[model samples]
Target chain A: MAVLLALVVAVMLVGGGIFTLLAAVGVVRLPDVYTRMHAASKAGTVGSGLMLIAAGLHAFDFAILARAFAGFVFFILTAPVAAHLVAKAAHHAGYRLSRHATCDEMRDHTKK
Target chain B: MAAIVTGLIFAIVWAAVTGSLSPLNLVLGFLLGLFALWIIRRDFAGTRTVVRPWKLLSLLILFVKELALSAWRVAVLVASPKMDLKPGIFAFPLKVDRDIEITLLANMITLTPGTLSVDVSDDRRFLYVHALDCSDPTAVRRDIADGFERKILEALR
Candidate 1:
């Protein structure tokens, strides 16, 4: 049982690390702020969220697990709100989309 | 009933904060919750919504599945040699009016595949979303309508 639990923790930790690394790579590689927000908000959220859960599991205590779960929930709830606010602010600040972008309906919507 | 639900929520929060879920602590937390609710009873005002547990469960399941898929897709895109991306922001006409509903919808969209909600319009009629791949805006709109928005309506409304 202990060995199995260790294996699970190991897998979660490594998976979380890889996802986080991918998010970082995405932030650096993606062209514009909006696209980068996509990388950070979604992938980064799952990455850290998984690590939090793994930490809780490693503890092997119900209380710790509950606390970790609460942390995860709070993190998930707040991350998107922050990302949305930043995206909105950046858009309003006149940060243009990347040259590679296909279209921007937001500009059209605001024009009307 | 709203008060009972509020008390339950308080108890759970108390447990999480205290890092203990023992029965004694839970009872104490419940009593504390009742006291807190009584103090703010006027503000509470019994605002109630119908909660379908099964629908809620399904929404949660869908969110988890989407989270995983979104992460995987983004990872693959980031790792690829050539990212033939058509990133753009499109306006989604809002069907859900309530503040909570719109917030939930937006949050879910941000966490889903290739989409991040930027802002809601002044009148709350449309949500502006940034999509990593916006080659087909109609398909994306349909997916949001069918996937997260539909499930949110089922669960919350």
Candidate 2:
């Protein structure tokens, strides 16, 4: 059981670490606030969630697992809301997408 | 109604699994139960969605697969030496009106790669979405309507 738990923890940690790193790279590389927010919110959540699971398994304590799982749930519930607000604020403030962006349906909708 | 009872029962099961009967244990169990029911809700006879649990699980599996695929696409785009992309914002007219439904759809979209839910219109008729690549708006709209919105309706009633 201990071995199995340790293995799970290790795999989750590594997988999560890579994802988190990718998200960081996205923040630095993406063209605009909107795109960057994509990287940060999505990858960040999955990465953190995996790490949280790893923590719970490593601890092997019911209370710890419950708390960690709760945190994971909280992250899922909150991250998207946070991203939505930031993106809304950015759009309303007139932050344009990268030059490669092909359309702006939002502007059209808001105009009419 | 069934879901709540299932959650309560799940809490008891959880307490047994963990060998504890504390209130906290029960609460945690309840949460797990709720989560479980939310996932397999279709299997229960009293479930409003009334789809197979496997179907619901498959939907989620598809969603996660898409999530990873999009994330990878974004990652590759960013890694490319020259970043040439067209990021556009578009109004995605919504089929869902209820607050919870709208919220769920928006969150799922945001969680998936390359899309962000900006805002909903005053009357909740349209959701303003910013797609990472909006060259094909038709495809994006279809994907949302057929995928997230459809699955949400299936799971919740």
Please provide, for model 1 over B6-111, each residue's C-alpha lDDT reduced to its tens digit, 9 standing for 90 to 100.
Answer: 7998998889878888999988888999999999878646555677889999999999899899999999999898887899999999899887789899999998
DockQ of each: 0.84, 0.48
Clashing pairs in 2: A100-B85, A100-B86, A101-B85, A101-B86, A101-B87, A102-B86, A105-B89, A105-B90
Q: What level of docking quality does candidate 2 show?
A: acceptable
- Span of ten consecutive residues with least summed lDDT in model 2 chain A: A62-71
Q: Candidate 2's C-alpha lDDT?
A: 0.81
List the RMSD of every prediction in angstroms: 1.9, 5.7
lDDT of 1 by residue, A1-112 (tens): 9999999999999999999999999999999999999889888989999999999999999888888888888888998999999999999889999998888888888879
In order, what lDDT does every prediction score? 0.90, 0.81
Query: Who wins the TM-score comparison?
Result: 1
Model 1 TM-score (2 dp): 0.94
Misplaced by over 4 Å in model 2 are: A1-4, B1-63, B80-84
Q: Interface RMSD, all models, one decimal each?
A: 1.0, 3.5
- Per-residue CA lDDT of model 2 for B10-102, tens digit only, reads 797677557677998889999988988788756554424334566578667877787667667666766678866678888898988776679
Residue pairs with backbone overlap in model 1: none
